[model samples]
Target: MALHFTDVEAALDHLLARLPAGLRVAAPLGLGKPHRLLNALYARVEADPSRPLHLYTALSLDPPSPGKGLQARFLGPFLARHFGEDFPRLAYVQAMKRDALPAHIEVEEFYLQSGALLDSAQTQRRYASLNYTHVAAALAARQVHLITQKVAREPGGDRLSFSCNTDLTADTVDAHLARGLPRPLLVAEIDPQLPWLGGSAVAPDGFFDVVIDPPGPHPSLFGLPRQPVGDADYAIGLYASTLVRDGGTLQIGIGALADALCHALVLRHTDNARYRQVLAALDPDLESHPAVRDSGGLGPFEVGLYGCSEMINEGFKRLVETGVIRRKVVDDAALMRRLADGTANLGDHARLERDGEYLHGAFYLGSPDFYAWLRDLPEVQCRAIGMRRIGEVNQLYGGDEGLERLQRRDARFFNSCMMATALGAAVSDALEDGRVVSGVGGQYNFVAMAHALPDARSVLMLRSTREAHGRSESNVRWNYGHATIPRHLRDLYVDEYGIADLRHASDEDCVVAMAGIADARWQAGLLDAAKAARKLRGDFAAPPRWQHNTPQRLGQSLAPFRRDGTLPDYPLGSDFTAVEQRLVRALAWLQASTATTSGKLRIAWQALTATPGRDDEALRRMDLHAGAGAGTWFQARLLGLALARTARDH
Candidate 1:
């Protein structure tokens, strides 16, 4: 039987007693990192300066900054003012932001919940750029002497289940045990709120050395709500969604881009005519890429996709509910074949046997609403989503190759990258000079999986440019030193402009292809750099058709659809009311305008002209009845922001 503790300090004291100095503690990435245990461990390590605590994990969430300057300033106050007490202020956020973390506490991140802000420098220096599949191997080499994870009890028994994160823990233990390594210290923090999922859920009494059942619910800080998908993100999503085959397996990353893709896909499945309308707007030559033209069509799913996503978010849930994400794949070969042949029936679970799970996820953290939905699900219903070790889900080449093949047939591991070299290499986390913004999560694993599965393809989405400090910086560059996915593994790359089909393309062609998709403003600089470096001839020019890849063109194309409300910032749907939706539209337009000098001037001029009482469309765009409840606050703020911008411009 495991020793039970009333408090974190005492529990960790017992845990520390079993371990040596210079401890390497491993845990599941994301929400699975037991915050209480970590706080206690941090305090314990703080007291002892000689022993350095090496911590390894991935996708660690930090306190989200609303954004830069005016956006963060105005939006932060607005959210707090509107939501009031309902707004979340997570304490774990400070762990990444502040300097309370001791120097001896070495944090090694495998991934980051990226949103332009990278808080810690010490953690960045200790970053490990390993594929998700190799995370276990790396841990084992260090003789990972300790493991602590969050788990849920079986209502009454000592048997526990690793609820949110089965990703790294089980596989690490299994690998260690198979190699005859001494069992690491296992500590399980029992939280009642964690949903008990099946498939490798059960753990015997002997598995854990200590169990700490906390008094309160594990604090689930709502994940950064989906970012607003503006014209750029929508355009990217529109093109990227075209690459998704109806019958294929889908893997997506988090944030606005994923949400945008989900919206586009839902449109494709439920309303193809509307989907085609928006996609055609993105590229007049929608048939340019044969794959997007043929395999990717505007139609409902005849063969619904199976999801082997490493991380499941609100988008996945929505997809599931809409029946857009229904095809199930387990380890069984026959079931995989059935799924491929459009004969697989999930209702017949007995006949449609599973070797592992239908959907293998590591850890999940979404909005509070998303979590509430997850918590309310029945055990049988939850069976469809099986949380597995990160090692297994991240890498498909290991262990059962045949089984993985069947489970991940037609796999499209769609992920985001910070930048990509014109020659087709990708940069996900860090910059070229070595400032780590985020750690390389499962991007390499998915890229590898895409390669391992002959039918699969890695669809990496690189937004053309991200506004940083009010300047648009291109995500496509001449070359980047730090590569998340090397040029060799290059597959399909997409940006707001269009798709770059670089697979099997020559270096010169890769340059042309990448340039074609990059933001038009930045493409010249990229090409100039390439020419200076002798990679391209001085006379070389972007393909004639590619010259149409301009933001102005994209905006013009999307103009008509904006009025019909087809290309919305939140395409799937919005929980916000009509009034709130208008506010969202206006606020987003205001924030986005900061990216361009001309845009700022135009918005400033418009704000200057609009008087408060009159029914200005700009005012109406924010809200119709501007003096009611939250709308009252929005009206004041909107006017104040306009005034502020006008004065600032002067």
Candidate 2:
């Protein structure tokens, strides 16, 4: 029998009364975060101010607002206005930023919500960057003292499902039991609406110490902020799409670039003609790029891919619905080997393996639409998309590497990073001075897994340059103080301009390839730096084959038809209406221009000096006019600037 309480306050009173001070609470990351319980605990600590409560979590959502400046001002309002309002303020974020919590409350995070956005020194000092594969190592070392999770009520049964957070939960429980540690206090907040993911999410009735189903929706559901795709991102995604061979394993991360890559893959699999057109517009000489020429293809997958991601995001759901993510992976090592060797097929495989899943993910966080999709899925289809322990999905050294290799053969762990050296060393987390941007989540594990697998490779993606603190900085540089994926584990690197296949290339070639993909303005400095370090020939110059490697040239060649609206912000398509798209584009331009010193002035100059003209279609679509209202002034200004750029281009 289990004690159930409708009042969270009463439940907390009963639970905390029994537990001593210095309670160690471990919760799930992302969507699985139990905000209500955490808030209650924080409130209790706030009242007492002496209880030493410890928190262990990763990639938990922070408040929408972080950092300071024009970009923050602009992006903050834009986000609050649309897309994300259901997300609530985080107790962890508040404590990290302002010291709002008790002094004894220590937060040890495996990953952060958005590390790059973090500017708090205290938050940086509090972070612990752990490899996703070795999370259990940290757990074992720390001796997990307590565990609480958000779970879904079982259908027609008195039980709970681990639901959205099976990633760390199952494995944590298994590892905890194996270590023979004293059984910690276990509790669950039951949300009946949460999907009952049957594979490993199912749990017996007596799993928790107590259950609470409070009557109102006090803890808002966490949702991932939807990132809009852009031209550079689309081009980068197009290049990456070509590298994903038919019937290979894919491991894509989250964010705009990942979404763009997903869109490009969809186009390749469903609409190859348009994909080629966009590719030609983005990389005219892709055929000249040797790595791409040797391994890349512009064709659709005759046999589709199997997703093996630590985070199964909204993109994977879309891929699954489109039939692009269709390869089933079995749990048994022998079955996987047979399937890999082509001796057994999904249709005729042993009946026992029928329960084999199409994708294996650690956890997920996406939009409200994505959660709705998950909630509405039938039981059988729900089983097709399974969640597993992070220890299993994140590492290659553990159990069934053979089966993992069979399932994730030709694995391409496509991930994003902040910076990398020309030699392929990467910095996915933290800055040179140890300011934590985002904690190293699973990129390290996937990179090592790729290196260990015979046919696997890691594909690292980033914009060649990113605007930070109002300055454009090169993401591909000669060297950096920190590295998430060191030079030894280097593989493929992609930017908007092109792909740098550095897997087996020499040091000099690595420099050349990195320079090839760098933003044209940053290339000379990078090459010069590499030479200063004696990594490249003293008199090195881009070979004759690299003559057309400037941004201006790339702009004209790779995306020649961008102005004609052939390459809209949403290249594949979007749910946003035409009016919304137009508005979003204008906002994007304004935001980018305002972020830097020269941007607003540049836009003003273009609006003044360039030919005064009209884009009636755009104005009509966005419902803005020359003399509507005060609201129209902003739109009108943006339209004029866009038109000015168009006049100059023509």
Candidate 3:
């Protein structure tokens, strides 16, 4: 039976009591449901009068959640009510956005809209879709509760299987006081798929107040607001989708590229249904399996596609509902049952839909529809894709025996890349300092898997250019930079410009192929550079036909589908609302701090102004002067793209 707590509060109380006075909690960040239970614990602690508590959360403030409103008013009071002056709340927000607000737990606006996803039945279903229903139980797990890490053995003393490396904040604490818990300890079992990093270690075997294990937590499910799909997005999607050959395991990351790719694939399944007929002719016994039935033989099968990701957001949920997502095979019935019921292994299954087939994640963020679904994930309906095995290649988990079973199955690995070179060098991660911007987080693993499977190939999606300062520029070409995936490992590269088959292409051929799809305006520049640097070889050279980024060509290629549909990059959704946009603009205008302040003001200004015009041609022509910062123009660019597409479609 799954470990049960009376309610969220009971679970938190259980955890709080076990924690040593100075211990810290490092939990998953972002649109996952981990925050829900976390907030509940904070609220409970906030209500307590005698115990002064210090709470800190790692979140980037620029992407403010609608949930923040509820947190400030409801949670802030609970903390103040319980701990009085003793409560100290700190939020660690990245200082990237110029207009980012200072972190505080208190409510500044009495009428600020609460950031909580609306509570409703539909929300429950959507949440269930992404597998966020069992967050409460997952936190109760032994491995999860304890923050464990791989630490070098301390040269002496009792060969510690696990040792408290440091507090959650990595502060040194009195070892005696730190050794607060007794032996035969309670460990909060965690999902192994979670991003592993050094530090924040938990105690090993002993040191338990009580050991509680709920199934692995589920991922967040978010729904995109009805928005228009741009030609650029559709084009990219079409190119990316072509890489998935009927039967390969798939992994799609967040963003428009992910949405576009998935959406386009869905379209292919409908428009070119017979392309997958080979799978239809297979035996009914194999076909009867949910996992097998879902493959729908659009391409050849390697291992078939098993969706393994850190996020269980709405896009994945859509795949499941549409029968595009299939069930995974497990040997044990009890495990499957637990997985279905929202209870299973932290390292194994996520929340139980049934034991072995559980869905799991650390947290969630989404619309009420998504939230509702999460609350009631039923067996046979939901599957949690945990983060623990996030980066592991299929071979590592299943081993040679499992590989043999999967050998016949070709898994096409679909992942996003930040940049794809003219020479077919694909960079998915940071090239500078080898300091990973995002952990190798499954990209390398999946890529390796793609190489291992004969039928498998990695599809790397590249946007030709991103709109900046109200102007389009090539994302395909830039000055010297390192590649995340070097030329040797290059496979398939996709862009709004087109698709480039890079695997066996010569360097010159690769450049010609990649440049063929680059923004028309940049093709000459790329070609000039390639020829000048002696990079061009053989008969490969830029052709004259690739001379312009004309709307006519893009139109013909993408064929203006429904405007109001999901795209890939902003796949799950964006929180920017019309009202919120206005407020942000107002906030930006009122704050006259510096170039940074004006830059933020510009984003809202352009978005609001641009939304009114069709074709967004006016907005596109409007120059924006934003100072250096990350994701500075996301809101404006997205709005402009949506507007342009909407106008064109209508």
Provide C-alpha RMSD values for all models, in order. Answer: 5.3, 3.9, 14.7
**What's the candidate order when arranged by decreasing TM-score?**
2, 1, 3
Better of 1 and 3 by TM-score: 1
lDDT of 1: 0.72
Query: What is candidate 1's lDDT per residue for 1-650, written digit by digit as tens?
Result: 77898688878777777788889888777777676787677767776888788887776654445674434544564455433434334233355566456767767766666643355655566678777777887888778888988887776565788877777787788778877898788888887766666566566557888889877534654344545677778888888888887777889988788888888788788888888878777766775677676446567888677777778887788787777887766666666667557786765465454333445677776765676677777665577787766666777655777777877767888998888999999998787777777777778778877877877889998778777867777778887789878998898998888888877788877887888887777778888888887778899876676677777888888777765767665654554545444445556656676567887777656555655444344344434335567645544555545534423111
Which is the leading candidate under lDDT? 2
Candidate 2 — what's its lDDT? Answer: 0.74
lDDT of candidate 2 over 65-144, digit per residue (tens): 63343234334544554445655566766877775555777788878766533776666666777887677656656777
Better of 1 and 2 by lDDT: 2
Rank list by lDDT? 2, 1, 3
What's the count of clashing pairs in each model shown? Answer: 4, 4, 117
**Candidate 1 regions off by >4 Å?**
50-52, 65-100, 115-119, 154-159, 334-350, 353-358, 378-380, 524-545, 572-650
Clashing pairs in 2: 115-437, 116-437, 281-558, 282-558
Q: Which candidate should be chosen as best, given TM-score against the real structure?
A: 2
Model 2 segments more than 4 A misplaced: 66-87, 155-157, 218-220, 284-290, 293-296, 345-353, 544-547, 557-568, 571-580, 596-650
> What lDDT is reached at residue 51 by model 3?
40
Which pairs of residues have clashing backbones in candidate 1? 166-388, 167-389, 167-390, 168-390
